[model samples]
Target: MTTRHSHAGTPNPLHSLIEPRALLEIAALPAGLPLLASAERGDGHPVLLLPGFLGDEGSLLALKYFLRNRGYDVQTWGLGRNLGFQTRHANALQQKIRFMHFKSGRKVSLVGWSLGGMFALYGAKAAPECVRNIITLGSPVSMGPEGSQSPPLVKAIYRLIAHPLGTHGHLAQPKARDLREQKRMPIPMSCLYSLSDGVVPPQEATIDGDPALHENIRVPGSHLGLAFNAVVLNIVADRLAQPEGDWHPYEPTGLTGRLYRLLTHKSLPL
Candidate 1:
């Protein structure tokens, strides 16, 4: 179902402002390389991280580092680049989860960003026995056709790219059957979204399932920032620390939470 915008609409100011900033932030990411250089490994349950569109395992390096230091067996989807929604993509990730389960003899936790989050959710539904918990950063799981809030120019470019590659190619539209399948299964989930996200509209990022099974945490940052933002890192750390069947929703507390709350007012959809 598509979310209807307010009819008394002028263009959404936040949407206009954020799109360019998201591009700028992405370009400047190289400067933060040193901060994520130190990788840490942890014990207990294994955690796998999935990066956003056009992202690779390296995009999640900072989050991996922080989770490792806090104590979790963190790893990346050794997949080279994120192309878009495709059947083969799911197969590749399912293989990874199966391997981890076999080797560790324990269920793993999944943390994914943007497109990666959708894949993680898909993986969980396909093999729920292998996943203990699922967390997503600015993933558009609920939004249907009109949910993509990209600029017309960007949308046009993606359409052009998808045409040559075929619908299941680089920019294929999400399959309705897949979405319907996902909605049928409600895994323990947490969706972390940003009011300041420049990519997806906040509402699109939310999970429309039972509140008890799914929780939404709102933060202040850009879409790219969620991967490395200290505030987001703390929330992830707190959630992963809980034991299975005793999972609790994250309520951002302390100085960082306060700071984030003070700086932002808009909440993104999980």
Candidate 2:
């Protein structure tokens, strides 16, 4: 049996090459709006949407617009392109989280895609007070040897551009200390990954922790499509829409709920 934390060998290299398939899901977004309309709406909470590494706010426009239309105060990571985690990125992200929480007069719900999702998890631990909920799309739980399952080429490219990605951040402490805290989420945390994800492996994206505060949901889409995929957005909306201080495992019930379950045929992780 496959445990939630199992690596199950390296992820398939083919998925990394076929990441372009995400474009199809993006193209299908418009047609899925009607279905999204049936999702639960929150109490006009604030949401901070973060893009994957190297991507900017523009990459997340579709999902941001979708959430905004649903009555959410959706905003982007203000620090331009996600240029790997550096001192500036860490400091700015911390300030952004605090500002969003204070400005909206509500705790900010974080919605991150790919590398952005990893950043969200990091931010949540550093500033748990400001973050109300955490939702990640195809984000690995750890970038180090512990959880990374990216293809060798992907890792090589990332290392070439941005060395020491996770080690240096706002909450950069003893590596072991940080890892320990990361395992214990102080707020509701949900992870969504696709079985056929082209970049992030399903195991790496899933979390192993307390059932009360953590859940790993399997969506159906390419890694690049996580931000625009209808099902992914729907799950984020429903998770963020939960009443403040109230969090629960996600089950298919929104407008696209049945379609998601039918397509993925996954029982979900809690």
Candidate 3:
């Protein structure tokens, strides 16, 4: 007899149990500093960083420092702790993007982690003109096959602190489906996910859009530690370094590149 597993539309509980590994990933950050230091520097462009649910500017300090040190002017989502995306936050972000674009006299790049990715996507869609490029780290962006595949525990917590867990999150429910399924943003986007992520599955974190416009790059680490992952920072550096109107696909290099080539996912365009 053959035993099979079922598709439960949720992340495995075991991954949740090991979420503590995020700490290990954070502790190991210094080990990758040498390689990270070699990444291409920025061009003094403005980049906004958004943290995940219940996270605040504090959660993105490491990323801000890394990007700022590389010559980019990095700023954090200043709306205090992200208590799950809501209407008020969305409006505020739209204003923020406009100001950043106007003040800098250049398009602003958005770099978001986890739920923060949701905010970034929303912002880009709202004001693509003000935005340059987008990079998401381990965010739960539902693709074609998945429809808000949030774990039960996450769902419960979200409903309590944020909006109701209806079809598509209340943050961008009506447009959320359209955001992924149709009306793709014109902005260049890169999604970095970890196979080891526990909070959100890798599939849910990537985009299923035009191959030229969207990329699903895989990194190694935990969901909680993605913001601190060196491989992630390197990819962000490489992606951000691309000159406007001269963008191309990310060519993985170094040990991480070797590991990326080994992946059978074949993230090429459809």
Best by lDDT: 3
Task: Report how far off residue 203 is in candidate 1 (Å).
Answer: 1.6
* Highest TM-score scorer: 2
Report the lDDT tens digits of candidate 2 across residue range 1-270.
112545565566677788888888888998888778887776788899988977899999988888888899989988888766555676678789999888888899898888787678767777889999988888766544454567776666676666745323322445334644575577888888777786777777877767777888878778888888887888888898888877777778644666877878855443
Error of 2 at 166 (Å): 10
In candidate 3, residue 112 scores what lDDT? Answer: 90
Using TM-score as the yardstick, the better of models 1 and 3 is 3
**Would you estimate the TM-scores of all the predictions?**
0.79, 0.89, 0.88
lDDT of 3: 0.78
Residue 202 of model 1: what lDDT?
65
Q: Residue 4 of candidate 3: its Cα lDDT?
A: 12
lDDT scores of the candidates, listed in order: 0.68, 0.76, 0.78
**Pairs with backbone N, CA or C atoms under 3 Å apart (clashes), candidate 3:** none
Clashes per candidate, residues 3 or more apart or on different chains: 7, 0, 0
